[model samples]
Target: MSRTIFCKKLQKDAEGIGFKPFPGELGERIYDNISQEAWQMWLEHQTMLINEKRLSLMDEDTQKYLADQMDKFLFGGDYDKADGYVPEGK
Candidate 1:
């Protein structure tokens, strides 16, 4: 499935597992407010993105951040993982 489609399914699955998407952007925004540990964890996941090709089932920006993180790690390698935020593709 395409990125967006996959992400929607992923979120739906997460909800099924009892994790709601943040109540709103405020509950999710972390750019400059995340703890250092969280940031490091994000970076570690980014490394996985660079090492693998599985698309995330999260929102668009989150998916993009993964791609960018992978790019940074891989030295500008191409990333085709789906942008899973928008629910357009299926």
Candidate 2:
């Protein structure tokens, strides 16, 4: 059976991810608090950030920036958005 958590991002109880999505303390926090659906939303947003900003994963600064953005996206409730992006079907 799948585990459920009170997902911080979604603000409701939902199915939890199978494992830690990242390393260290943040990963543990996410594992305990974030749901799979919320995590998938973050993944899609992160991809948009990477593509829009032309970020390189190999760069240390880029990694830090992404981490900061991830924190805000997951918990801070003030996440950034891709510049000039317009949702489909307006």
Candidate 3:
């Protein structure tokens, strides 16, 4: 049986990730509160942020920025988006 969590991002009960998606306390927090669907959403958003902003994962500052954005995306009720991006079929 799949586990369910009170997903913070979705603000609803949903299927939870089976394992810690990251290392350390943040991973533990996500495992406890984030849903699989929400995580997938974040992944898509992260891709957009990377591509639109030309973020290099090798850069420490970029890593920090992504981390901060992830926190806001999941928990802080706000997040950054690619500047001037329009959704497909919009």
lDDT of 2 by residue, 1-90 (tens): 799899999999999999999999999998999999999999989998999889999999999989988989988658789879875688
Residue pairs whose backbone atoms clash in candidate 3? none
* Prediction 1 global C-alpha lDDT: 0.39
Clashes of 1: 3
Q: Could you tell me the TM-score of candidate 3?
A: 0.92
Residue 44, candidate 1: how far off, in angstroms?
Answer: 0.3
Worst 10 contiguous positions by lDDT, candidate 1: 1-10
Backbone clash tally (model 2)? 0
Question: What ranges in model 2 sit over 4 Å off?
Answer: 88-90
Q: List the global CA lDDT of all models.
A: 0.39, 0.91, 0.90
lDDT of 1 at 24: 49
The residue-level lDDT of candidate 3 at 3 comes to: 99
**Backbone clash count, each prediction separately:** 3, 0, 0
Task: Give stretches of model 3 more than 4 Å off.
Answer: none
TM of each candidate vs. truth: 0.29, 0.92, 0.92
